[model samples]
Target: MLKNVVAVVLEEVHPFELGVACEIFGLDRSDDGLPVYDFALASARPGPLRTHAGFSVDVPYGAERIAEADLVIAAATGIQDGFPAPLIEALRAAVERGARVLSICSGTFLLGAAGLLDGRRCTTHWRHSERLAARFPLTTVEPDVLYVDEDPVITAAGTAAGIDACLHLVRKVQGPEVARGIARRMVVAPHRDGGQAQFVARPLPAEDGDSLGGLLEWLRHHLDQELTVDQLAARAHMSPRTFARRFQQETGTTPHRWLTGQRVLLAQRLLEGTGEPVDAVAARCGFGNAATLRHHFGRWLGTTPQAYRRAFGGVGQPAGR
Candidate 1:
């Protein structure tokens, strides 16, 4: 249903964020049997637009192109005190006509300026979250999530997270198969829950000899096995309490939370890449049963195992192929 997409470019846009929209929607993947969006780049000012990275891009379209878009994307732009009135009106008009709008990082500000984010839950990069909340007091700003999708609108946290938000829209409209295929071609993860925390409190320092890098890798490979905190503690040669504290300190999440995330990720991959039955995928991912898998998948992905596969299965084939 989301056939046409237009990325609205403004002066001083970040190249990476703009590229995220282009990479996900603008590319022609018809040869892979994926949907090819009628994608275009539109600018309010038109002509050459400067990027934050000391380069400029020639955008050939203008605001008129947005009128036909089923979805509109506002790429991250350099921080400015004001936005163009015509651009803001165009965004408001697009939403008025039932077109979805998405923003990456600071681009959420443009949505705010257009009055689209008013009374809606949204987010931006953590560094700019405070400013965004202060400026748009009517909007509920969630600062620490990868992205926020309040339907009709989606906002991503930072640079890489834009990929997550874009792929999310693809999955929502087209199907999980289309989203996964696009992610595969992009060499990125097919899905990252919008509710996942954006960042850890501290970076894992290289000199910290008490690192859990190897242990984490082992856990990823053995997701089907039962992993208790006590067992993991003994493997790390530390007491249970000590291990728990260390994991929280280093990863900014509890061991259970981290392990559950990994399991869910594995389940997603298996569901998308194979035609295995729900019960088998559940047991393979340590959920033990189809019911248990459904519970966790619903909690994390807002969909059931069967539904996920229905949306994303086929090995390399596109949905309905």
Candidate 2:
């Protein structure tokens, strides 16, 4: 049912967050057998736009484009004269017309300014979470989540989390199959649950690179095999305690939590891409059985494996969150 998407590019916009919308909705991947959404970049004024990086962009469309959009995404733009009035009105109008709205990073502040976030649960960059909550007393701010989907309103934390939000929109609008297809082309994980913590504190040191990257790849490929914390430590050639500590430092989560997320992601793919029964998908994803898969899938995706399959297996089926 989603036919058009309007990305509201503001002055001082973060190119990466805007690029996330373009990557998911604007790209012409129809040649690869994915649905093509009508995506447009619009601004409050139709003219040269400035990026936060000190570059200029020419956007041809204006607020009028938001009128026709099925969805509107507000990309991060550096704070300007306390948010322009036209942008606020345009955003308010879009939501009033029943268009789904999404905000990335500081973009949520724009939503808050428009009074749209008054009674909603939303999230933004972790550093700004406290200020967002303090500024908008009516809004409940969740600091750690990568994104929050309060029905028609979605908000994402930071820049890369924009990808997770956009893919989730695809999953909600089309299905997991379409989302996975797009994600496959982009070479990123398709469905990281929005509820998962952003895991930001343990910043990877610049020189070390990601020590667990290789281990993660191996673990994903061998999901069917039993993987334990101690075994994973041995694979990393470190003591069990040391590996556990480092894993948390690097991934912002314990190994067990990370492994659970990977298993759930695999189960989601299997449910969407294969007609195999739930038990088979479970076994293949290392969930042991359908019941185990159901428990984890329900816990992670807020739906049963069968329901997810039914939704993403084909068109005209209801897409589950």
Candidate 3:
């Protein structure tokens, strides 16, 4: 149903954020059996737009194009003094006509300017979250999460989080198979929960020895093993408290939460790509049983394992916040 998409470009747009919109929506992927969107870029005054990266993009469409879109994207432009009035009106009108709008990074500020974020929960990049909240007091700003899908309007944290948000909308409307196919072609993770914290790693001193990269990889391969904080601490040659602190510093999340996320990700791959039974997949991912898998899967993906399997077979909806 989300066939048309328009990414609204403003002065000083971040090319990477704009590219995220283009990569997910503009590119033709019909050869891969994925849907091809009627995607284009629109601006207040269509022409060569300067990017914050010191480059220029020749956007060929104007604000009028937003009216035809089922979804509108506000790519990152940081905090700007003012927005184009006509473009803001178009964004409001598009959403009022039942279309959804997504803002990546500081682009959420544009949505705030248009009054779209009012009375809704939203987020931007953590670096800009405080400013967004202070500037838009009417909206509840969640600073740490990757995104907030208040639908009709979704706000994502910076960078890779945009991919997660867009793919979620794809799975929600076009089914998991389409989302999976597109993600495969993109060579990216197909699903990341919106509630996952934004990663802000702080590496230990070089003398503290190579971070936990190797240990993290080991855990991923041996996810089925019932490991505990104390056991992991022993493996890392540190006290339980020291391990927990270092894990939080390096991963931006507690060890338990990071392990759970990895297991859920593994479960998603098994459910969609393999014919393994629910219990088998659960055990392989450390959930231990179908009920536990269902519980975690439902909490993480907002869909049951059976529903996910069926969705990959061409039905069901998946989303989370």
- lDDT per prediction? 0.88, 0.85, 0.89
Query: RMSD in angstroms, candidate 3?
Result: 3.5
**Model 3 clashing residue pairs (backbone):** none
TM-score of each: 0.89, 0.87, 0.89
lDDT of 1 by residue, 212-273 (tens): 87888898889899989999999999999999988877776789988888888888888878
Candidate 1: residue 145 lDDT (0-100) = 90
Error of 1 at 317 (Å): 13
TM-score of 3: 0.89
Q: Give the C-alpha miss distance for residue 247 in model 1, angstroms.
A: 3.1
State the displacement of the C-alpha of residue 227, model 1, in Å, after optimal TM-score superposition: 1.5
Model 3 per-residue lDDT tens digits across residues 53-131: 9989999999999999999999999578799998999999999999999999999999999999999999999988888
**Deviation (Å) of 137 in candidate 2:** 2.0
Best by TM-score: 3
Q: lDDT per residue, candidate 2, 282-311, as tens digits? A: 888888988898899878778887777776
Quickly count the clashes in candidate 2: 0
The Cα error of candidate 1 at residue 243, in Å, is 3.0
